[model samples]
Target: MKYTEEHEWLRSEGDVVVVGITEHATTQLGDIVFVELPEVGAEVSKDDEVVVIESVKAASDISAPLDGEIVAVNDALADNPSLANEDATGEGWFFKIKPSDASQMDDYMDEDAYKAMID
Candidate 1:
């Protein structure tokens, strides 16, 4: 998985890419109370606001780090918003998309770079 300066993580699985906020983002946002995901089939550009996560502290936007078409969303988060706090990059993933270009994934920060930004 690769992370972005904005704190989203992208895990490419075959042709689709799974997206979520990093654990660091959840930590900064406090306890997540709700998450809003874009509908399947929506086309998005790089850095577009596609998901909104509401924490007890404030609502945060989760943007697409690459241009893509929304394919699937993590509906589980609707009923389990705290999953973002417990496992931000795992079961708490927000959505998945079929990217316009696979190589765009490399444009985001790697783990080390992301940590440095947060730290």
Candidate 2:
């Protein structure tokens, strides 16, 4: 898994990369109340806003972590936004993207580095 400075986490699974907000991000956002996900099959460029999350404290946009095609989105978040707080790294994942350039992942930090940055 790799983490971005924006507090998004990426996990490679087969040919797809799964994306989600880190637990620390959820903690800062307070309790999530709404989620708007990108449509599956949409092409996206790195840093493009793709997902929108609304928490009691504020609303935030989650950017595309890499240049890729959005292959799947977690529908569960739409029905129950708190899933992001309950299991951020697992069930709370936002989407799975098929990266156009896998090397784009190299720019992110590993878990230890992410922890250090957050600390």
Candidate 3:
């Protein structure tokens, strides 16, 4: 998995990538109350605002880290917003993307690098 400075996490499974906000981000936001997911088949650009997450403390935009076509969204989050707080990097994942440029992965931080940044 890789991470962006904006606190999104990404993991690839062939051409599709799983995406979510980092646990640190969810922690900072407090308990999640709502999620706005992208529609499947939507085209998105790097840095584009694709999702909205609202928590007890604040609402934040979850931006795309690479240009891609959204292939799946977490329908589970619709009825269970607190999943983000419970498992931000796992069951709480927000979407999946078929990245337009695989090389775009090179731009993100690996787990250690991302952890250090937060440390």
Candidate 4:
């Protein structure tokens, strides 16, 4: 998995890519209370605001790391928002995106680089 300085994480799963916020972001947001996910088949541009995650403290937009069509979303967040707080980089994943240009992944930061940025 790789991450962005903004706390987003990306992982490749065969042809599709998974997107989520890191534990760092969840922690910063305090406690997640609502998640607004994008619709399947919707086109999202790189860095576009595709989702909105709200916590008691604030609401943050989860941007798309690359241009892609939304393939799936994690509706579980609506029922269990705390899942994001408990395991944001894992079970708290936000969505799956089928990137229009796979090469865009090259612009993202690897785990080590991302860690250093946050640290």
Candidate 5:
């Protein structure tokens, strides 16, 4: 798993990459109440706003961490936004994308670096 400065975590699962906010991000966002995910098959560029999260504290947009095609989304979020708070890096994953350049992942932080940054 790799982590972006924006607090998004990416885990490569075979050919696709799974994306979700970090526990630190969830803590900052307070309790999530709403989530708006991008459509499957949408082409996205790195840094593009892809998911909208509305929490009790504030609304935030989760950006794409790499250029890719959105292949799947966690539909469960629409019904229960709190899933993000319950298991941010697991069941709360926002989307899976087939990256245009998988090497783009090399630029992100490893767990140790991410922990240092958060600390």
Candidate 6:
């Protein structure tokens, strides 16, 4: 339930998985303007490119933290990209996944490890 140096976070909600950028990423990207999300039912691999978040200064590719099939996407980001920057870990979530390999979750960092990487 933490993030990577690349700014992606992995959180599990029952069998579903949630992915999004970290607060650090938002700060670095500045004011976000657009978020391009993958379609539901699309398959994604660990570290695969799943989204594109555009900011006032740059556009960043949001990668997946584990291998999974996309089940849901945050359509709200299309109308309010700032939400990602405002609360990257909460309302800013980009996609929900149903992991193709549930055990792949073991490859991700824990909260302390993720925080240290960003700090």
Model 4: CA > 4 A from native: none
List TM-score per model, in order: 0.95, 0.99, 0.97, 0.96, 0.99, 0.94
Comparison by TM-score, 3 against 4, better one? 3
Q: Which ten residues in a row have the lowest lDDT in candidate 5?
A: 77-86
lDDT ranking from best to worst?
Answer: 5, 2, 3, 1, 4, 6
Clashes of 3: 0
Better of 4 and 6 by TM-score: 4
As a TM-score, model 1 comes out at 0.95
Question: Residue pairs in steric clash, candidate 6?
Answer: none
Off by over 4 Å in 3: none
* C-alpha local distance difference test of each model: 0.89, 0.97, 0.93, 0.88, 0.97, 0.86
User: What is the full ranking by TM-score, best candidate first?
Assistant: 2, 5, 3, 4, 1, 6
lDDT of 4 at 19: 88
The 10-residue segment of model 6 with minimum total lDDT is 1-10
lDDT per residue as tens, model 6, 1-119: 86676878888899998888888888888999999999999988877888988899988787887787899999998789999988889999999999878887887789999877777
Q: Which clashing pairs does model 4 show?
A: none
Clashes of each: 0, 0, 0, 0, 0, 0
Regions of model 2 farther than 4 Å from truth: none
- What RMSD does each model have against the real structure? 0.9, 0.4, 0.7, 0.9, 0.5, 1.1
The runs of at least 3 residues in candidate 1 whose Cα sits more than 4 Å from the true structure, single-residue gaps closed, are: none
| Residue-wise C-alpha lDDT for candidate 3, range 1-119, written one tens digit per residue | 99999999999988899999988999889999999999999999998999999998888898888999999999998789999889998999999999999999999999999999999
lDDT of 5 by residue, 8-108 (tens): 99999999999999999999999999999999999999999999999998999999999999999999987899999999999999999999999999999
